[model samples]
Target: MKNLSSNVTERTERRKGEEEQENTEERERLENNRFEDQDETTERARCEWDFHLRTVVSSATAASDALGVIEFGPSGELLATGGIARKIRIYRFSSLVAAASDADGGGGDVALLDHASAYDYYICTPAKLSSLRWRPGAGGRIIGSGDYDGVVTEYDLERRTPVFERDEHGGRRVWSVDYSHWEGCSVMAASGSDDGTMQMWDPRCDGGECVATVRPSATKTSSVCCVEFNPFGGPLVAVGCADRKAYGYDVRKLSDPVLILDGHQKTVTYVRFLDDRTMVSSGTDGCLKLWNIDDARAVRTYKGHVNNRSFVGLSVWRKGGLLGCGSENNQVFVYDKRWGEPIWVRGFEPTGESGCERGFVSSVCWRQVGEEDECTLVAGGSDGALQVFVGTRKPS
Candidate 1:
């Protein structure tokens, strides 16, 4: 009877050992699988340089002239493009349909299968249009246009006529016109001209008189290539000049510049504020400069893109933390907005010289989609069409 009991105990012990080994092996297998899943997820969220060509719109203008500027509507429902052809074209969002409408009018549920679609209409300008800006809260219907004849016209698109016209530059070409977009931003439009002056005009005035003007020092009387109000909600405005210099002026004090930032070797084409204290300027010198408003000099410079003929403005998409610009060769180069490091480059090349002549990319803007890890970049081309690129943002 004792021997039988000992055999039963031995059997029980062997069975318990086998069960423990099985449990350990199962746990090990689960841990290995968990690690594999973690790695796969990390790989999926990583940022990839997979910018896809969305659509191509050729001969966007009837005149076949160079398209120099493109701006997104305040609500992203429309696009406004203008250029040397003296025409302002408006395009409605193509994805908004009965089948695509969301509760918030966002059309988020729609699938954009044919991404390069836009229905276009145009309005003629009196002179070669140099710049076009949409008024705030006009739903992209009201446009303020500046021309080479130093004329500034505010037009109501729905009305199909000019609200007012101003010749503040006085026989000089109005190189740039931009809205302040602040508390009373649209109340007055800022115009920079080849007449070596920057003037503010109130379109509502009966005569379209210049209410204010920014006068730089005796040397800065050179043609003002571009002028933009400080977007950080202030009275400061930065104006780029043909003499390879940029000056920041307080709107309250037009007699002198608050500070001057000079670093480019050639003409300064565009200047804009990334923040109240930080700004970026691009020039024909094939470089982009970052300047601190507190200092009189630029902190850093980015290069490798050329700009000789037309102004290729620097665009900063703060949400995506990106900075990029176009070249005369039609190439678009992107960089890290924070550190100014090159990321990727792309350009459109058709058959030959006929396309190349109009292929120059003069300006670019980045538009971010709603709450999505994606953005659409549009470049104004000399070919009369806008080059569109869609990019996906990778998880950091």
Candidate 2:
């Protein structure tokens, strides 16, 4: 019977797919990375925070999500940027101050900060970078970067040389990378890739080899969009997945996830710990949620910033309950977790003014306060522009 044979064949194909998904989960589960804890943390709240846009700068004209990367030195004295191009640029904070004084394009007291004359160097990667992070140490002279080619390279600015490199993702592009240091542990780095694995690397090891691998997804076919280590001093990591699930895993035991949070309507683009007990996650579905990790449940959901499978960054405000993220509509959005909607979202037309490049805002970070005299917020996106924001909080 031809009809009977066709039905049986269809059933066999469906079963095969299910089996493959299960095997993928099994293989990826036994892997792990040193990205700061991405898991929901359990900690006390800090003081209230206030933030506002301040400066903007750019080197190229065209838009590139790859170029929308920006990072501050550990001490906040220097800033580094590069992604779409093969070269990375470093600038001194004071140099930006000097630019603020320039008459022609110097943007008044605090308009656009341009210190492009500071430093520039080429990276050996064949493709553009996807992520960049500065190593934490006394001088913060070393930086780690992941590229579209699935390679991870560490550069030593003090030595002006490539310190180490490796590719453990089967030639898949790396999406995110981060470094971490425990009180009595060797420094380690974590990189998430399109290959559906997040691998950990030890710098002191020969050739900076991968120490462990983890699969924080329900199925092996899902890609890891973001990975972070818990700064609360644990073996746990929070991972965002293309499958629309965010998982919590302990490196010590990758065979099983400690917790799984699923509710996003699309790919989970970013996941970061708000504190030791709470985590913030964003999805292409256009919803940002804060989860109380203790119970593995959603505490609140904030909306406004749009994401269509983009790696948007999220950071907690120091004072009380503020959260910030970049938007697909070329804006920087900040919300109070206490509210259901964003407090405000701001951007300008791409008129080529100092910080007015109205391209999709993609990457964002909150500058550490002790290192920065003021509460500082920074973001980068499609237009290859770095926009900076300063907080205006009156003293308590």
Candidate 3:
């Protein structure tokens, strides 16, 4: 009886030891898995940066005219390019859609079946597409284009034709057009002409008439280069002019620019509202300045590009905290707003005079895709080509 009792005790001890060993192994396995997951996340972020660096390797070439401006559709699935060629070209977003589909299928060929399709090029010309914009809330199926001839045309994707056409500026070149965010068809457009006048139009009315006209103050004489609507609220307009000043106007009362932002020594080429209270402007001075709308003061200055005396394009990614600038020097600078410095610089290699023009960088914009926060930067230049830069955040 004593030996049997001892044997039972030994068995119990052995069982407990085995159970403890099993628990330890399980814990180790879980720890290993957690480490692997962390490693994967880090590697993924590095890969994304690498991909962004490589995607623009050859300097994308699309348009064949001195490109004036580039705009991305709401879904980032389409790109609208305009330039001296008097035409607007649309490029599809097949690359992103295909990549997403592949990622969903375990990053394998199985997802190719669901890959996004490419779009055929659509061209609009004769009116001289000076500026292009995608209608808000339309999912990128509608586009509004302003012409050097002071005409505004709204085109539908399905019909591939202008649904609405109006010319109210009396042949003054329409420099910029913006659609309201809440109402797709509600548009507030501005035109700057050789006559040195700035006029606003609201196309939603039956007889599209000039909503307001802005003129220079007694001390200033400048041609309006560009005009943009404030992203915040209300009917505020920001206008940049050849006289090297940016003016903010409340369309309701066009007595004068509410604020006169003067910093550029040369012509101010472009001005875009970053948010409700902040705006950015670029000029021939080769400097990009950030302004405070409330006080009408310059807060920050970003100067890295060369040959700003000519034309340059500026685009800001409000949420991603990025700014893309293209200059006449044939270079594109991508800056992190937080650091106030460029994180990456890219340009085309000179190839038998086929590279970006030495003194012309026309337009730039950040292309937003689907629901993802990722965006790609695109620029247009005098070489009549479009260049795209994909952006990614560094891993933590």
Candidate 4:
């Protein structure tokens, strides 16, 4: 009886040990399966986000010339675009599509809408519009535009006609226009001409006269390509010149540029102030250079595009800490301010139509709504098409 009892006990102990081992193996298998599933989910999300990084909407073909500049309304409800054909078109945010996935938590799904006909915001026929900018703080009810005829026109949102028209530069083409946030009617604009000079204009005056003009003293003679006003206000402007150099000027005393930036081997096409002391410039030399205006030094140089392909447009998203650039190569690149490599490259797809490759991208802007943390990137192509991309932080 004792030997039978012992055998029974021994068998029971062996069965319990086996059961524990099986449970341990099963738990490990489940853990492994969970890890694999997580990796797959990550990869799939990445692929989807990448797909969204490309072109989202192709603006209507009937808008006439290649689109040159794009701007978003203060509420993100409207997108304004300017083209070489002397026309300005406005697209509503309601037409855009919100991406489905939540990858960045930066904001809600990216806003990418299908191609729809522009709302024909305002038409400046015979003007040859060069740039468009919506006044900040005003509910997108006021717009300012610069034209090749050296004219700056301010249009009220409700009415289709210009409330103010000023030929501040004696009919020299106006290259860029920017309004001040502190003062509504106060505006600072720049004009670049074949004569190799940059003139600043203030439209608030009774006649909207030229406030100041800057020219190369003796050694530098280059046509100004673009100009931008400082976001923090005061008498500061950044200018890009064809002479392959950028100059910073104090509108208070424009006798000479406060600082001269030298880095681009070709013409500097665009200049934007990221903040009070830091500015960014893109050039036909196929390089994007960041400068510290206070110290008057080039802090970093970004090189990716080959050859001097007319890299003309640049903008910085103050909220996102990202910079966007458009080139004549039919491509747009996004770069993180801290990193040297581009976060992503977009707009390379063929339009299935001829002459699309020659379509130079003129401008890019970021539109945000309410308290959202993220913004959508809107670009204007030379073919008079507006494209939107809805992703963040992609490998170049």
Ranking by lDDT: 1, 2, 4, 3
Q: In model 3, which residue pairs have backbone atoms overlapping below 3 Å?
A: 63-384, 65-384
lDDT of 3 by residue, 1-396 (tens): 999999999999999999999999999999999999878855542222321421221124343466678888776667777777766667665663454455454432211211013224566666677778887666778787878887778888777887777677678777777764423224666666534667766766654577777775343345677877776665677888887788887776789678899888888878877777889888888778889999999988887777446666788887765677886777787765544445677774442245434545567887644323466777766676455555554454
Off by over 4 Å in 1: 1-49, 60-63, 95-117, 137-139, 184-186, 351-358
Give lDDT per model, in order: 0.72, 0.72, 0.68, 0.68
For model 2, how does the per-residue alpha-carbon lDDT over 125-167 read when each residue is reduced to its tens digit?
Answer: 4568887788766368788888888888888887767878887
What are the models' TM-scores? 0.78, 0.78, 0.74, 0.75
For model 2 the TM-score comes to 0.78
Displacement of residue 157 (Cα, Å) in model 4 is 2.1
lDDT of residue 313 for candidate 4: 70
In terms of lDDT, model 1 sits at: 0.72
lDDT pick, better of 1 and 2: 1
**What's the CA RMSD of model 4 in angstroms?**
14.1
- Runs off by more than 4 Å, candidate 3: 1-64, 96-119, 137-139, 182-187, 217-221, 350-359, 369-373
Task: Please give the lDDT score at residue 7 for candidate 4.
Answer: 100
Cα lDDT tens digits, model 4, 294-357, are 7889888876654365434787876656678876777877776655557667764544365776
